[model samples]
Each structure stands twice: as C-alpha cells, then as structure tokens.
Target: MFSKTCEYAIRGVIFIAQKTADGSRIGIKEVAAGIDSPEHFIAKILQELSRKGIIQSQKGPTGGFYLDAQSRKHTLADIVHVIDGDQIFTGCGLGLKQCSETKPCPLHNEFKKIRDAISKLLRSTHLGEFSEQLEHKLVFLKR
Candidate 1:
C-alpha cells in the first residue's frame, strides 16, 4: 500500500474534494476531522498539496481549502508522486538496495507485479471519481 502520510493525504484530498465539489470551502479542522487525521499533520499535507498546485488554499476567516476544475483531474498517482515520490512504484519489495532483474531478490518478481498493479490503479483513479464515490456514499473516507 501507501505510506501513512500518503494515506492521510489521499483521505484529506477526498474529503476536501467531496466538500468542494458542492462549491464550498472546507477548513483544516473540518478536513482533518472528516479524515480522522491530525490537524497539524493534515495542514502540512494540505500546504504541500497547495505548493505543488495539486489543490488550492487561502487564508483569513473565510479562507479554506478547495479544488479547482483542473485540480479535479489529478489522479492518485499525481498525489503519490508529490508526497511519496515514485519509490512505491520503483523500490525493492524486500527493501534490498540492489534488487533488480539481474540481481533479483526472493520476492522481487512477485512484488514487482504487485507494484505495477498498484501503479496502474493509482494512474487510473482520479480524485473526481473518489469525490463522486464519497458523494454517493459508495466508499467511506474515514473509519
């Protein structure tokens, strides 16, 4: 799967997208509460997303997080790349530094297949879909 940070980031984005999809802004407290993440940690994640242009944020009493039309097109892979890099797609399964085709680890082949499948999924799953799913109650973002 994904790192804890990436997991929180995805949840945070989905929560924000669900709220913003209805043309409303959501505050950090609400987003963190919705996703069951720490407010400060989620704030940092939100700041990073904003910095990378994956989402937008504003300051002041009415300021909050919201997704733009272009941002709605971003896929899970995009957020993964921003927050976790491509390591999840390229790293060794057994955490071996030199594990590869030529110097394959015991689990390298199987793990490669799994990693590729995850990469394909992330690439194909856009935030908009998750937003819609959240809207329709097809999936739960928080426990």
Candidate 2:
C-alpha cells in the first residue's frame, strides 16, 4: 500500500501527464485540483519529484509541473523508491527484524510471494500508460 503522500503523488503525476500531453505546463493549484489533493501537500511532493528528475517544473507565468515523453517512461517503483525506499520489498511481514528464509516468520513465505508480485507489477508498469485510462474515465484516481 502507498502512503497518503505517495498516493497523491501518483495521482498528481497521472493528472499532470494527461494535461501536459498538449505541451502546456500546469501550476500546483491545477495539479491539486486534478488529483483531489491538498495544494500544499501536492506542491511539496511535486517539488521533490522535480528536484529528483522524476518530473519537471518551470517558473514564471508558464511555469508548472510537466513530464516529457521520455520522463513518462519512469516506473511506479521509481516513485515508490523515492518516497518509501525499498522497505516494503525488504521488510518482514510480521515486523521481525531477523525474519528471513532460514529464520522465517510465520507469514514469511506467503508474504514473499505477494511482495515479489507487487514489486514486479510496480517495476514493469510505466506512468505514461495510465493517461489514456484516466482520459477516458477507465480508471479513477480518487474514490
């Protein structure tokens, strides 16, 4: 599961990708409204993303957050790594520090399989692929 800020960042990025496809930049207010996130929170997330090169931003009248076609190729795992690191992939399901194959937790084997699947899903999926689903209402970013 994603943290609330990660959730907003993912949603905000998708919305920005959809809007920026026309080659126009959008401000924090617009991104916040598009993704239904708080302006201040989304602003911070976007700024961090811009700083990290996951997304791009500009200043002045035409300044805002936007992603180039190439940047859109970044995977969901990249954002997850940026915000949450690899903790989910490497942590114990039962919250034990020493949980491992030899010293397995009760849920270790089962949780490993589930975690691997999720990791694969995130690593293999790109941000660009979601714009069409969102543009056509095939997916919803917010409940």
Candidate 3:
C-alpha cells in the first residue's frame, strides 16, 4: 500500500505528463481540484516534488508547476523515492528487520517477489509511458 503523499505524487506526475508539451502550467489548486485531492496536502507534495527536482515550479503571474524534460525521463521509482523513500520498496513486509531468504518470514518470498516486480516496473517505466498506459486503462489505480 502507498501513502497519501505517494498517491498525490503519482497523480501529479500523471497529470503533468498528460499535458506535457502543451506549454501549460498548473497551480497546486488546479492540480488538487483535477485529482480530487486536498489543496494543502497537494501543495506540500508539489513542494516536495519541486525540491526533489521531479517537477518544475515558477513564481508570479505566469508561474505554477509544470513537468520539465527531466520529468519525462523520471521513473515511478524516482517519484516514490521522493515522496515515500526507498524503505517502502526495500523493507520486509512483516516488520522483521532481519528477515532474509535463509530465515524467511511467512510472507517473505511472496512479498519479496511482488516488491521486486513493482520496483522493476517503477524503475523502468517513465511517467509519460505510465500516463499513457493509465489513460488507456492498462493500469488502474484503486483510489
């Protein structure tokens, strides 16, 4: 499961990716409204993304947020790392810090495989490609 911040990050990336190359910049309010997210929270997420260089932000009249060329090159892993950190993908599912193949937890093998697959996909697929797949219903978000 992902955190709210992670969800917002994904949505923000996808939204920007969809409108990429249109020279359109969106404010935090607009992005929150479009994604049906809370304004303050989305703003914080946007700030984090900006700090991480995952999205570009401008100030003043023609300023807001937009995906730069770097955003197009960014993978889901990058976003996740920015918002949720590597721990989400790297930690043991059962909360066992020392769990490993030799001394596997009950769900270690299964969870590890799933985690690895998710990590692989997130690391390899860019936001642009992810947005296209999402638009085509190839990928579905539960919430």
The candidate scoring highest on TM-score is 2
Residue 27 CA displacement from its true place in model 2, Å: 1.0
Better of 1 and 2 by lDDT: 1
Put down candidate 2 lDDT per residue, 57-115, tens digits, no spaces: 98998788899988799988888888888977788888899998999999999999989
* lDDT of candidate 1 over 23-136, digit per residue (tens): 778999999889999999999999999999999998888889999899999999999999999999999988899998999999999999999999999999888777666777
Looking at candidate 1, the ten consecutive residues that score lowest on lDDT are 127-136
Task: Order the candidate numbers by TM-score, best to worst.
Answer: 2, 1, 3
Reference-based lDDT, each prediction: 0.91, 0.87, 0.82
TM-score-best of 1 and 2 = 2
TM-score for each candidate, following the candidate numbering: 0.94, 0.95, 0.87
Note the residue pairs that clash in candidate 1: none
Candidate with more favorable, higher lDDT: 2 or 3: 2
**Deviation (Å) of 30 in candidate 1:** 0.6
lDDT of 3 by residue, 49-131 (tens): 88888988899998988887767888889999988889768889988989988899999989999999999988998877755
State, as a TM-score between 0 and 1, how close model 1 is to the true structure: 0.94
